[model samples]
Target: MIFKMAWKNIWRNKVRTLIILISIVLGIWAGTFILAYAFGLIEQRVNDAIGYEVSHLQIHQPDYLLDNDPQFVIKKSTDLLNTIKKDERVKAASQRTLVHAMLATASNNAGAKTMGIEPQGENTVTQIASCIVDGEYLEDSDKNKILIGKKLAEKLKLKIRSKIVLTFQDTDKNIVSAAFRVKGVFSTYNAGLEQSTIYALKKDLDRLLNLKQEAHEIAILLQGADLVTDFTQEQKSKFAALSIRTWSEIVPELALMTNSLDQYLVIFLLIILLALSFGIINVMLMAVLERVREIGMLMAIGMSKLRLFFMVVLETCLVFCLAAPLGLLLAFGVITYLQNTGLDLSSAYGESYGALGFRTIIYPQLQAVYYLRIMLMVAVTAILASIYPAYTALRLEPVEAIRKI
Candidate 1:
């Protein structure tokens, strides 16, 4: 009976009721869309970080990561790699002989981290072959061939087939210089990576370093990101002597960013709800004031103050009930369309996003839980917003309210 009365009462003043409903609908729709976009952006960053930069997990000599010394190579890396490959959790693994070195050409020079990689293994693990914009990925048969980033190529004023000198310390701590022709030039969203890293065949690099069949690091990609912690734990038990790290441990900032964004989304939604609350409060209060005589008559006829207060609260809830589903549907439609078409900010924000290693196109995504959460929040907001107006109705003196116009 109270719900039916509340529903009829709200429509008695159609203009005011509709104004509040519109506010609720727009607020929910905007808040949901914004949150979805933010989630998509962060998700994209995590994917790119895994796909291009960190892979899922890494194994290295205990001190190799401390200074990246060429001599701190993983022992019997081939056997270890084969063992890792046989693990069902692992999608792919690649061994790398990394050295900090100076890369130079006739016209220019720059310090770079040169990575020695097996072509086939690297293709499986990092997918570097797909990023090649010029020339070809390093091939096992291509002796002394190197893959440089397009940024580095520009800095060195070199192109494909251009010869470059790689000078680094060999295993004996002796400075060794080797000549490599730039067989490929690749480009990635990360400017720092593009300028500071290059790839070469592991055999060629091992021969130069005089560390046969050893590697400085083993990069592993898992079938899914959720498997990272479990796989890391298992690998730790297997390779107790070597240091194993997951992508999150290696890049704590990415983990922190993802967590922080979740908190920000909650805060953002609260702000939207806060704004919508005021409109509800205003409309409900006006409804109570305009119906003073009717409320007085009901109280005079023996209706309790508690019942009056509840009727007002029920009215407020009905407003939200009418609007919430429509708002959610509109938000869902927009999100689904954008997920397929994508929102392109590339032209306007490409350079900034590229520098930070983020893609310019974003596809918004929202989980089912988010919809449920938003609906609960809106319901809570309606209840809270009704309190003050309901109190005003409860305070109305029956004789005084009945005498008023």
Candidate 2:
């Protein structure tokens, strides 16, 4: 009876109810929007940084993972590449030979790592072609041409078609010297890649190192990023001699940075939610104040204080039970629209994410747990926020409440 009376009383002051509902809506919307966008941007940066440099997965000789020495070569890389390519999970695969040494040349010199790549195959799995700003990406047709970092090119005072000499220890522990023409200079938002790496044709490095068909690593692009773990496990059993590694395993610093950012954002959102809970408390208090006479009448008519308190608390719950789902629906609608249209933060933000190794465009995604959590938080807040109001109604003297307006 008390519950039915309280439910009817909630709609008596329609304006006040609307005001509180609006506040709840706006608060949840802002929190949802900010958290979703921030997470999306972080994900974009991590993937871009990894894809731009590391692809998704790599296969190397068992010892090469321990120490990436030029001498640690995969003897039958072609056979392994063929076997990996046969897997339906594999999107694209490329073979690479690497030499880690300082680059010395007339135009510029620095400690640099050289990566030998199959140009066409790399394009399928990497953003290398997009990174090229000056000249063009190295083609298989260009035997002696190399693509270099813009910073490296600037340090060397080199231009397109300019000649640069590379010195590194070959597979046989001999210092091999080779001359390469600069086919292009690539610029990345990634400072590390822009400063210390150079790319050359696999054939060129194969000849320079006097290698017949050996490679240092095989880079694989998976269809989906999350599949890296499952694919790695599958590959481990399929290829016995090689070690499989994901981008996160190879580059832990990026993972650490993104993970910290995610945790910070989650904490910040929780604070906002707590603030919203206080707003719910204020509204419930006001509802109890206006209903003192009604509460007193219920008690006079033989409704127990304990039952009245429970009813008032249930009233608070009904508001949240109705509003929370609506809030979630509204949040989803807003996020989905923004995701499809893409929040045009690029113009205002201006590609500042290059340092973080992410693209300017951010695509929002909804995780099931996030929405589930929001629902739980709102429900708990509504129930707990009514405690003070419920207590006030219980303490009211029936005669005094009836005498007052």
Q: Quick one: best lDDT, which candidate?
A: 1
lDDT per residue (tens digit) for residues 50-100 in model 2: 577777888888887777767788888888788888988889999998877
Model 1 misplaced regions, further than 4 Å: none
TM-score of each: 0.94, 0.84
User: Which ten residues in a row are the worst by lDDT in model 1?
Assistant: 187-196
- Point to the candidate with the largest TM-score: 1
Error of 2 at 107 (Å): 4.7
Clashing pairs in 1: none
Q: Please give the clash total of every predicted structure, in order.
A: 0, 2
| Every candidate's lDDT | 0.91, 0.80
User: What would you estimate as the lDDT of candidate 1?
Assistant: 0.91
